[model samples]
Target: MSDYKAFRVELKDKIAHVAINRPDKFNAMNADFWTEIVDIFRWVDETDEVRVVVLSGVGKHFSAGIDLGMLAAGTHKYGKDVGRNAELQRRVILKLQGSINAVDNCRKPVLAAIQGYCLGGGIDLITACDMRYATVDAQLSIREVDMGLAADIGTLQRLPRIIGDGLARELAYTARTINGEEARSIGLVNRTYADHDALQAGVLEIAQEIAGKSPIAVRGTKRMLDYMRDHSIDDGLEYIATWNAAMLQSEDLRIAMTAFMNKQKPEFAD
Candidate 1:
């Protein structure tokens, strides 16, 4: 596995765990974080030994949003001239978007395990994942508005599709914090465990289960599902037909069939 300054990555039993490791800063996103996250997800896509990824934070909170210190230092797109500065900021926004898109476009599934705070950019991070689980006491917010900014990352785009447009708009406009139970009730998270330990255990169990599946099938399923989110029903069906035409020819299918017939487990190759 690649060494990451902002994240702790561990691969075991075909499941990769990626935890935000900046507890001293409440895991806030900084320059190193933006750079490293893209690298981490790209590595996940390239590595055949990994099947699923569980994303979490190291301390009591998931993330407190982008580091204000970075902004004060003018680390992001900033220029002295207005015209050039606007262009520079636009470029920076696209770069940040691409960084989060790496997680969304990853071939394998990503499951987010949230504990305390998941605000602003943290929401962007989790909304990009395939699924999200949280501790009951966790707090979440779409907090960019409070900072006089629209969330340019994945949250505004992906969250509306996950929850509904009305609720998404309400959260974006009001910048209100919601507890984990409300997050789950509104379909932001799949489930809310009693505490952080339970959240980690639950998400890890699910990740392990996903890893146990044929990697080809698991990856194809994620691809098709992501496709269906934007395409029409007819378009999705046609696409899946084309997809399975190639995918069905895999040896994993034969192994799966034989395993079912023999009532035994099947070992699939990468």
Candidate 2:
């Protein structure tokens, strides 16, 4: 695993656990922090050994939004270095988007385990995951309104589809904090745990369950589902067929078929 100053990457049993390590700062993303995040995600995606990735924070809160100290001091400012400002601005936005997009776009499935305060950018990260679990103490908000900006990362886009558009809008506009129980009721979180330890354990267990499946089939399923949600039935069918055409030739197909025939477990070689 690549080293990170603001995070730790632990890989075991084909699962990657990435923990935000800025507990003293509430896990806020600083320039160096997000740089580490981007690199680690790219590293994780490049490996076949990693089948599932889980994101969590190590602190009393997931994050207290972007660092206000940094914001007030304009640490987010960008300059194009003598005529690159415009492109730099776009690149900056893309890079920030990438903090979560890297997680979303990883080949393997990702699960976010949230605890304590999940605000602003934290919402962006969790929303991009394939699934989310939160602790009872979790407090979440689409906090961009208070920060004088829009939720530019992924939350504004993906959250509307997960929770209703109305709920997403209300949260964005009001910037109200909602606890984990309400988050579960509104479909923002797939499950809830009584505390941080349970939250992490639950997500890890779920990740292992997914890891036990056929990697090719599992990854393809995630990709096809994403396509189906965005495309018409006809388009989706053509895409899925195209995807399975090559995947069906793999040894995994033979293993699964033989396992069924023999009434035994399939041991897929990833």
Candidate 3:
């Protein structure tokens, strides 16, 4: 494992586990932490070695959201630091947005294993993932409203696509916590585990299942699904038609079809 203050990343057998490591601070995102997150996504995509990602946080809570100190720092606008500092504040927000985008943009599937308090910026971080699972004791919320702001990252956009506008609006407007069972019922979470250990095991099970699939098919599916999320059905049809123009001719497709016809398992080559 590499040394990182904000997070820890380890890769093995086509799976990557990313743990938010600022436990003392409830895995809070302070500027550098978000920047590191963006870098991690870029690195994973570049290496192409990781087929799936399991995201979790160290300690009691998945995350308590953005660090309070960083939020307070924005109030520095009232002081004599209005020149460069204002620009710095905007930059910080942009970087945080970029961090969320990194996760969403990764072609590999991502599974979030949440526990404890996953609030505010934590909600933003997670809405970008492909799937979410939680411990029964977990509490989740879009806490930004409680902070006098809206969820400015990927959550406000991608979340509605997953859970629909009604639930997303309710969570953002009320700033209320949702437990794992409720989260699962409402589609905010896929399932609930009895505890952290169980949650971790479940996360690994799902990640490995995804890692076992053909990378080309999985990546193409994720891309197509993301595209279809915002596009009209006609648009999606045309988009995929263009996509499959060449992909349908890949050797893997031929092998898969032949194997299926012969009642044999596929042998996809990288």
Q: In candidate 1, where is summed lDDT lowest over 10 consecutive residues?
A: 71-80
Stretch of 10 with least lDDT, candidate 3: 74-83
Tell me the spans in candidate 2 whose CA falls farther than 4 Å from its real position: 72-88
TM-score rank order: 1, 2, 3
Query: For residues 157-190, could you state the per-residue lDDT of candidate 2 as single tens digits?
Result: 8999899999999999999999999999999999
Question: Each model's RMSD to truth, in Å?
Answer: 1.3, 2.5, 2.3
Q: What shift in Å separates residue 248 of candidate 1 from its native position after superposition?
A: 0.5
lDDT of 1 by residue, 99-121 (tens): 89999999999999999999999
Q: Per-residue lDDT tens digits of candidate 3, residues 227-250?
A: 987799999999989998978888
Off by over 4 Å in 3: 77-88, 258-267
Error of 1 at 19 (Å): 0.6
Error of 1 at 269 (Å): 1.3
TM-score preference between candidates 2 and 3, better one: 2
Best by TM-score: 1
Q: Residue 58 of model 1: what lDDT? A: 97
